[model samples]
Target: MSQSPHHKSFTARLRAHKIFGGIKPAVYKADALRSRVMPAPLPGNLVLPLLQHQGQPAMAVVEVGQAVLKYQVLAMGNGPLSVPVHAPTSGVITAIADSAVPGFGAQVQRCIHLQADGLDTAAELQPCLDYRALSHLQLLALIDAAGICGLGGAGFPTAEKLRVSIEQGVELLIINAAECEPYISADESLIRERADRVVSGAEILQSVCLAKRCVIAIEKDKADAIEALSTALQDSSIELLVLNSKFPTGGERQIIQAVTGFEVPRGLLPVDAGILVQNAGTAYAVHNAIVEGKPCISRITTLTGSPLQTPKNFEALIGTPVSFLFEMCGIDKSQHTGTIMGGSLMGIELDSDEVPLIKTTNCLLAKSTGEFPDPAPEQACIRCGYCADVCPARLLPQQLYAFSRSEDLDQLEEHGLADCIECGACAYVCPSHIPLVQYYRASKQAIAERDRQFQTSKQWQSRFQFHQYRLKKETTKALDKKLPGAEKTTANEPAQPFSRDQARDEIAAAVRRVAARHSNRTAPSSAKDKAKDKDRH
Candidate 1:
């Protein structure tokens, strides 16, 4: 029998598929999941963290004893890179301390404990319904006032992204619906349920960026989502593109390529190619920010895994504890030994369920022993190229593994270690079951630490050099001032044999030449011509 041509490649090996063992899909649910249009009653207590968005954490303006109302700015966003923190509900500020944050690497963050007043009283909001009359800057101020951020994993301030896009001349706004991760159904569910809101948000983004076109790209697997968005935006300029459901297709770079066929170069942003990509959830948030007076106080989270009694999406409050979520779902944490904040592919394991939800907590997975068995003990690498074949970033996993193992920072950098997205795709496919992503992360962290130290050293060196230069200039100036006829000195005289008057003449002449050149370039053409004619006469 003739062998098939496909048998020659990794596709054949992948087809074998013996490793995963046909694991059944698990259903996870959020008990209190609510729609943006619906008025979901606020949680009993809201723990609004100071650092909700990316960039510098917002500075807390309210004291512990102070009372605050809903939509009130409890903390002010710091710098151009951050967004303000708003009270999720009317409450008395209880305390500010290091608190647990879910899906985040850091166990402790600056958290504001709020005891909800339960009245949900309105806070004074600066209204700008007639946004058309406002300038772009005015629109941006409104967005900032609404405390909007990306809402996707990035959590970047929305206004900052818009400002950058406008300044850089963005042509296309790509709305990402490619929720390619295994268990993350937040974006999918949002688009299916709130197509109109998502479309409206995209329009707002379109207006802000002044983009020529808007494209909502969803995965082909999400047929219902594609249909919903397509129907909603059929008459509009927004185009819906169904992309292949590849893992990491939801990544900024990948989606940019999938939609516009433009690859953002390594270490560059999507805006560099005149493209701006925002998450579907982010678009929805933008819509709410513009039309309705709301900040990103809550988001849809998928609470899934076999351990849970019920599995469905929930619109979770930002500061709700993970334990509270599990309790709401009627899941007994005692029954499950392991819990992860994200999907099995890339989620981080939680030390405890006491962690409070943050902006990036997309899904919470509780795994019983039967559902998610612990990985087999890691073994030595046998030089098999399986890891490389599955790497979404197209990096040499084995080589990176080798460099990481040896702590060869130079070699790792040369091998493009920073490009690793830590997606665990390579580790998932490794025949040797090496934790390639973990090793890469360790290496990257070490490299980052070293770079930080280098930067600090460079900063100190720069300061030292600057101080030395200043001292030298001051000393020279003092010597020139003390010397006879020193003010007349110029560059023509040697420092040792300093002829003050002659040096002064040389300096004056050089200054005159520079001033004349500048004046000639900046002066009116007629004035320059007349001066030239007078010189000739």
Candidate 2:
């Protein structure tokens, strides 16, 4: 693909940045981020929540005190858009109520607290040994029924995307392996450990989505992962595309553009442009869901930073309490000043480590003052426009920042505020260290809520308008029937009549006239009473 002039200018600016100044080109390879240790199993007392995925929270099927085996569906998918929650370990549901989750802000969701029996007993698997025989829709339904979703951070229902693509016609499927965030190495570790499973998962996803071709987009940094995936799927129909090692390159739209040279139009989805992308980790989960009847119970997470005595990767069970994982990894909170989930750039800081791990928990970074330095207090924008220069979406971050700061919501929306991916690229490069992405997220949420309210009001107005129109039509028909020689009048009425607005105004005027006449008739009774009082006086 030919580089656009805009892209060329942006690249030149990026090269001048202090952060990229002395970065060795060899460090861009994927092996630099790969964890040296294999992932370890999580601890007991998994706090599995019902609402892990992006859609409607899965409805709880297992109640408190109920025994649930590993891989057993604890919560079932409520609709076509939802995915089910499963037991990470064989245990008794201790509690079924609200629990704290990291990175969720103020939203508390219903959680199933499981006290493990240490048995780790899994339910009987219904393996699809002959998955080749199953039709596309059949395979998709199985994936949905198993409650599988994108293990990638988005957590959108996998089956729903497939169904949508089947209807809309998806031409290409891009498997994202660009773990672009600074320290989140879960996807890289997964690729290193389960390359074949990841590829198999991609094939299953491709079949269900009915895409003509599948492209696995791995970062040039992860050469080992690229080689492993390429070797595993050498004879398969999947193509591995090595992408540039850049922060936020793993974003669905960015990866899609890098691989297919297609820019997904603003406010439109990948499927709208005949593209469906899934994370490499999500692909592995899909593979297990289809072939092994395994639900997404566990995922690999990177436990790294300077605070921990030893930093490594671990296969964490969904709902595993953050406190337990930290303890297991020898992470002493007393020694560390703060903890952040995901990565320092885009991740959220934890108020407390007691929060349970959700499906999207990819990394837990415990940092002291030196490892991850705190930014200076935010100041006024100097109009450097460095943010816009590095923004992958090619949006004006400074403009968005100004609109958001002023709370000019209309102007914000007009500026395509919703299109901001909140990738923290702007904040990452900003000299003033302004939390531009946070403001954008808050603005987007507010705008989305407003839009939802507007849509609801519109629907109500439409319904009311329809009903009023029907009532007026009926009233007119009744009035005509009641009039003298109504049948003759109807027969003589002209085919071409007044416009609806004119007719409505006339009806309103007539109603007001009739009201006036009624008031006039009642006026005499009050006069007679006044005359009687005057005579008595």
Candidate 3:
């Protein structure tokens, strides 16, 4: 946590930047941040899903009933986008089967069920004390081995992002500490408690990406976190910028715009703008991976809402069930209505509490029966333009809603539905109480499915076309071999049709002539030659 004497403090004045069309929602995170991150009790059962990150799901390495230690690899990364899944604690693999996991929306994915033995045995770790001495690839390999990914968003592999950033020549690396979502302060809490670790992780990321400059962008409301980061970054080159606490400010594009005043072009990534943004918690995990030699098996999650007696953040394992957290937090079953993962605006309501936590899970809001009731009935759009005015991505929510209702994906794309952050800002400001974000979400899903089908169809079509081309090529080659003296024939003496019977007769005549010559030489010619030799003697 100490700063080097040679390092200079960043003297730039802290300035806040504005983003277009953002709403200021009630940040119900005070109670959650009241306590530090407490370690949750190890559950008897953990449901580790294979597809924890955003890529090809990890393939199971440990079979059923296999004993595994903490930090041991349970599943191996299947592709470049994937990160390995590690054992949260020493336990025996009970089963590997399809199970329900949070953020997967109703679909069951393959999960590794583990029965905790309570001993918490650990495997050997390869900690890098001096990451500066190692090459970027070495550091990234360590991160990959640690299974670190973006803990803030969709759980994109951190190694992959860093690799891409390095390839794109990143100029600025932005640490996203803006926990703008209401009732979710996991990032803020992390930065407040372990700002030094976050700073160190940012430095490692900067080193790996070879970024020219690095900055930590946080909300102005996170005063404690900012103070801690300022203290931690006293002798570092990394800059700290405080942004106004607004809804969706923590979004990648929004944070980018707020920090650098650059909007990511549609259909392009932030890296296209020479910028790389990572979540604050992801930075912390990087620090742990490089310095502490710990894999990303757990994360700090915010558990808050009216149903909990004592709401706070917990460093819960990845596969810990939400029901366990609810029980640990002393949930009032009589008043508990349901659990929503992430913030109220963008979170998905869980059908059952048995769903295990995944990498992207940041918040678990247990709503009371009356709290967070269903939205009002859908009303006709009055064209008041309120939804458009509050959109963070500057997308036409009204148009998107209409297109979504009619299943007009082309129009939706034309209006920039892909650019929509789904922050629920338009829905928050909607006059008709129409769930505009819901419509946009549905449209985005439809577009994704359509694109997937299109890509699959294109692949099949390409294969078919190649197959036809190959057949034509082979047929032409066979004909060339069959055609005799094809190139020798002139225009006036065009090649005649092939005749198998004529070729057979010609071959037979040639064989008969050879036999007649051989008979003449061996019979009467032999006697004449002998008489001539005797006369000469």
Candidate number of the best TM-score: 3
List ranges where model 3 is wrong by over 4 Å. Answer: 1-14, 104-106, 462-537
Clashing pairs in 2: 28-221, 29-221, 30-221, 30-222
349-388 per-residue lDDT for model 3 (tens digits): 8989998888889999999868777678989999899988
Q: Give the C-alpha miss distance for residue 342 in model 1, angstroms.
A: 2.6
lDDT by residue (222-274, candidate 1, tens digit) is: 77677888889978878777776677777777677666554556787777667
Clashes of each: 13, 4, 0
- Pairing residues by index, what is the TM-score of model 2? 0.80
Pick by TM-score: 2 or 3, better one: 3
Indicate the residue-level lDDT of 244 in model 2.
Answer: 68
TM-score of decoy 1: 0.79
**Tens-digit lDDT track for model 2 on 169-273?**
777788888887777778887887689999999999898888877888887777677778878988998887776677777788877666656567788787777
**Predicted structure 1: lDDT:** 0.75
The number of the candidate with the highest lDDT is 3
Off by over 4 Å in 2: 1-39, 104-106, 455-537
